[model samples]
Target: MKKRIVIFGSFGKVGEAIDRDLKINTNYEIIAPSKYTEEKSKYWSRNNCDYDILNFKEIKKILINLKPNIIINCAAFTNVDLCEEQKAECWKLNTDFVEMLARATAVTNSHLIQFSTDYIFDGLGGPYSEQASPNPINFYGKSKLAAENAIKSIDCKFSIIRTNFLFGYSRIGKKTFVDYVLDNLSQSKPIKVVDSLYSNPILTSDIAKGVRKVIKEAYLGVINFAGNDYVSRYDIAREIAKLQNLDTNLIEKIGINDVEFLANRPIKAGLKNQKALLDLNLKFQNLENSLLEYLTQLKISKESIKEISKNKN
Candidate 1:
């Protein structure tokens, strides 16, 4: 019998990619999205999900019914400024909901894999290894760190994947760094690209591959998985433009502090991929190669749109 896998936040880029990978690999039975729809679920889960993650009772009940051997949680309030302003919601989802999952997983003995971020660090010095001490400067980072702490405290088997700069082409209409660059440049809009903050952003599909390996290996621990290249945010945009042949003139170079933000950001906050490489044996796609793949997807997307339009006419 195949091990049953349940994925939450299946609509997001990471979740969608994982879902597709699992289906393609045919290693596990995947269940995506909570069964409850808007009318059937509660206020919070109304259109979002079927069950409230904070409610241990509901979480427990759901786990008992599903009986999944693996649970991959991709849900989170990721907007830094928004998380700072909405502290209550951020803590509830990022930290509290994860706590409930960790506790519930203890009962079912389900292996939980949770996605995390580089924001857990203060960006003092990086290309940080897995053992680096965490000192989050903002509420979002604090909440994510709290979630990691909660999972660690629990007895359940879990792997909190700490990744950075997630990039990918999405059929689900999720926005990415490439999207931001293309959309702005197409409209002839000038955009500010931060030069100070740096990270080794992993491709979403590559992250999905890493996830598959983790499940196959049954690894239970926190791991830092990201790209091989370490570059600044501004350079990321600059690279995107060069790959897509977009106008480089419109891209502006600015420091981290130049842009006003509600929450503090980490400069030089890139994750070291040595652990993932050694353990998972996953060699990540280089920045240029990954960005180039996005170009191919863009061509297909354009052709698909035109075909649909022609059919309608």
Candidate 2:
């Protein structure tokens, strides 16, 4: 019998990447649920049971029904600025919902895999290891930290994977660093990027592959899943320009203050993937290789769109 895997936020970047991998690469049975029905499988807690993540009773009911062997949580209130304004709402999904999942999964004997962010660390010191202490500078990070602590407090089998500055081709309506740069640069537009903040911008597909390894091994602990390259936003933009044959001068370097973000961001929040590499035997890609791969995906996406248009005509 194949193991049953439940992926929350099945339509999001990480969730969709994991879903694609599971369908193509792995033999596990996946129960991917999203807000809107993307397929015939009726797994959305709201549509099926009229209950969202905050409603513990409904969440428990859904988990009990599925009885999944592994539950990968990719859903969260990820808007950093909005998280600061909507503290209660953010905590409900980031912290409260995770606690609820911990309890429900505990009851069902399921291993829970939760995703976290690099914002949990203060920018003073960074490219942090798995053992580094988290000093979140903003409410978004605080809520995520709260969720991590909640999971730690419980006795349930859980794996916490912390990453930072993810970049790649996201699903429709989702914009990432790569998308932001590519869209503007492709249109011969000038792009201003922050140079102060640094991060290991991991590809979504790479992290998804690493997660598959973790799931297979059933690793129980914190793992810093990120890219090998530590770089600034400006450097990444420049690399993307180079890869796409765009003018490097089109990218302007700026400080973090120039962006005027509502929430405070960590300046040096890159995570070290030594632990993940050593334990899971995963080798993270550098910025150049990762961007090249992303470019190839973009080309494929464009070709597919053209093919669809041709078919329609």
RMSD of each: 3.5, 2.6
For candidate 1, the TM-score is: 0.91
Task: Show the lowest summed lDDT stretch of 10 residues, model 2.
Answer: 40-49
| Model 1 stretches with alpha carbons more than 4 Å out | 34-56, 305-313
Candidate achieving the largest lDDT: 2
Weakest 10 consecutive residues, lDDT, candidate 1? 39-48
Candidate 2's clash total is: 0
Residue 207, candidate 2: alpha-carbon lDDT: 84
lDDT of 1 at 247: 90
TM for candidate 2 is 0.93
Per-residue lDDT over 154-220 for candidate 2, one digit per residue giving the tens place of the 0 to 100 score: 8899999998888666546478978989889989999888887899988889989988899889999
TM-scores of the models, in the given order? Answer: 0.91, 0.93
- Model 1: per-residue lDDT, tens digit, 1-313? 8899988776677887887788886668777655454433331233424555556677668787888999999988888999988999899889988888898788899999998899999999987899999999999999999999999999999999999888776664789876888899878899998887889977888889899999999988989888888998888888888877889999999877788999999887989998888998989877888777767767888899899899999
The lDDT for every candidate, in the order shown, is 0.84, 0.86
User: Model 1: clashing residue pairs?
Assistant: none
Error of 2 at 238 (Å): 0.8
